[model samples]
Target: MTLASSLLSAISGLRHAFFTREGGVSQGIYESLNAGIGSQDDPVHVAENRRRMAEAMGVAPADFLSLYQIHSPDAVIADRPWDTATRPRADAIVTRTPGLAIGVTAADCGPVLFADPRARVIGAAHAGWKGALTGVLEKTLDAMETLGSKRPDIAVAIGPLIRQRSYEVGAEFVTRFTETNPSYAGFFVPSERDGHAMFDLGGFIRMRLEHAGVETIDDTGIDTYSDERFFSYRRSVHRKEPDFGRHVHALVLEAD
Candidate 1:
């Protein structure tokens, strides 16, 4: 079987993918391509999987970048070549150099890719709920801008997150958003479970991007928690599984 991923027509200087699990060599619960190196999967397997990903992106494994994502608003700017594992702590990374990829491993959270073609800058972010509410996306955009990126010139995309139909959260979640803007409650759909509601995560991201002045945006309509092609922390917990996998969503610039 073939691996799953999406192609972006708008990302001109880069080759990007919201990669899925079908094309790796891992097995059992981790099962074929668990790209989350820090996951419970064997280190060698994760290494091989990431190498395959580099080949797919037309870059060496050293060109790939990821973060020690903690769902915070922090951003890291990479000014030079660095190994993927050694990249610093932050949910987002931006670089003005080409051949450098920005990536984030995710299950249900959003893996967001950004590129500013004119400025030769690229960025990637992992914006889970906490990161989103805390302005992770904005931080990434700001870092990219500092490296000479423009909000209007940046093409933004989000991949393989839990969709609203699959995301049910507690009422406190709604209260938190609504406390910021009374109308923010529109993103929630009341759930069958008491005091819980289905939240529109992708919608919230889009809403914020629009607010942040991003004119071009695309969303990869994959739900990690609901689909077996991807991984989901919540789904694993609900299924009582020992562990889950994280798919890598990456964006890499092609050096001129």
Candidate 2:
């Protein structure tokens, strides 16, 4: 029900998981393990699903924190747990506080977990195209730095999301990126449809991380759009489904 990163799993006092939609009470499009508090799934089921995730991470259910996720470049520091009604509105969260499982929810957007084992600091970011373009990853790194994590010492794991082969975009979508920097054009290639291209979001994310001096990055390379194991917003849209489930990718600094 969960996927672990080899690099993150090797760490002594850190726990992380890329949860799948396999276990839960929600049915229909949100069938099981939909951790999104914002989703249309029944509140009771969502709570129970998240409770299971928190238990797996060895944290109290209330300690499993997630942001409101506005798809912005904002990152916040989580010094303590906050209830869903009072969760902060941001794209990323970083913390040195042990036992607090900071996480981010996503269906097609990138869910990146970061950690600096030596400093006992960890972070989670929701990087959709907008957040990624606006520098959410860099902002997350900066937040982690404030919590005593150095960029060079941090290892990042890119979890499940829609991949390039399943992602096609229009001319304006390509232009929005290339217009930012001409070199950004290489991240895309011609698609079968006219005035469209297949964009490599994972590659783009890696480039941003590398440019920011994060040398170690492990990508799960799982495409949500094609993978039946996870939910996909794009796939749901394609099928005209009302909504989709969201996977919660989290990281925790365990208490000694």
Candidate 3:
């Protein structure tokens, strides 16, 4: 199944989907629609799955783009498609190019889709805690602005990810956040385990976007860890699985 944001849906000339782990040819743990190019899944299977995704977005497979995603705060502007072997090493992608589907891959980390219909610019970011804290969201907005997108006019949608109730963090993790800004502590609450707390990743991502001057925001409120329909890194780890699949959340500006 594919999920979408109504706020983004209401806009014309935009196409996107927060694709779940469904409707593809991948097998085993990647059991369908796994778009992670870096995964251990068979390369042919991955390509076929991505082809289906590209078809769903009404773009050729070559026009569907994603990054290597090193969890950095970097955001790059995409004007043309690049080979998967040469995918840019960045966490976010912004583009004004129509018919080019730009996306980010994620399991438990947040996948944020952004669009400014007025400027016809769109962006996708992989917001793991580190990336979000280090400024990926702000960087994405900056890149969009370069393409004539106004921060206030950009509408953002936060996709499914590990929610607070299912995301437990160690003391060191909490310390890292609080040390960044004492107010960040508000995003965590005590967990049953001592020296650990549940982190609200979705809330933090939304807060970062809001601070970056984006006013129209929506969250899918789907938790990957607890939801079987989605793939999840944490859940895979907890289950002692070797690896997890990734979902591709993409956005495209349709051509006339």
Q: Please provide, for model 3 over 76-98, each residue's C-alpha lDDT reduced to its tens digit, 9 standing for 90 to 100.
A: 99999999889999999999999
Q: Which lDDT value does model 2 have at 225?
A: 96
lDDT of each: 0.83, 0.93, 0.94
The local distance difference test score of model 2 is 0.93
| Per-residue error (Å), model 2, residue 232 | 0.2
Model 1 lDDT at residue 13? 69
Per-candidate alpha-carbon RMSD to the true structure? 1.9, 0.7, 0.6
Candidate 2 global TM-score: 0.99
Q: What would you estimate as the lDDT of candidate 1?
A: 0.83
TM-score of each: 0.94, 0.99, 0.99
Better of 1 and 3 by lDDT: 3
TM-score of 1: 0.94
lDDT of 1 by residue, 23-47 (tens): 8989887888888877889989999
- Candidate 3 lands at a TM-score of 0.99
Order of the predicted models by lDDT, top scorer first = 3, 2, 1
What is the Å distance of residue 180 in model 3 from its true position?
A: 0.7
Candidate 1, residue 190: the lDDT equals: 83
